[model samples]
Target: MHKITIMQMLEKYPELPPISQGTVSKIEKQFRKRGHVRQLKKNPPNKLSDDQKLDVTLMLEENPHTSSCQTTSALNISHSPFSAY
Candidate 1:
């Protein structure tokens, strides 16, 4: 019938491991803001689409030992994606 505070929940559950109050508050705040407890999806710095990866693979297979600069120039892709290989 009563809502339990974060400290009370921690106190009631002896099986629960101890954590910093600050950490717990931060996590609770994040859950309230996001409506979920999971971490946010991280965007890769230089993510390549599946199609682009396949295209790069095929290009490399066709021209083995090709330089990264050459591959980028040939595929019209940026140096970052080519350098990832």
Candidate 2:
């Protein structure tokens, strides 16, 4: 069995737009793993639970002047949990 090189594959398809060797390798790896590569993987987002949301909301209501950094730090969170969602 002959293993085709990335450069060889790229040369075989001149119609393809310019792409990096690393990108080719990633595409080949994805294709081999999933049998196709056109569709992307959609992972579930990381969001706060209902209870966590309530806690944040209540905290904000109690102290409207709290800075973003102070709020996150006080809640023991590294990032702004509500902003991402």
TM-score of each: 0.44, 0.46
Model 1 bad stretches (over 4 Å)? 1-44
TM-score, model 1 to reference: 0.44
Q: In candidate 1, which residue pairs get closer than 3 Å at backbone N, Cα or C atoms, i.e. clash?
A: none
Estimate every model's Cα lDDT from 0 to 1: 0.75, 0.73
Candidate 2: give the clashing pairs: none
**lDDT per residue, candidate 2, 1-85, as tens digits?**
1135655756888788656667767888888999998888697766877876777778899999987677777877646466763
In candidate 1, what residue range of length 10 has the lowest lDDT sum?
A: 1-10
How does candidate 2 fare on TM-score? 0.46
RMSD of 1: 5.8
**Model 1 residue 6 distance off true place after TM-score fit, in angstroms:** 32
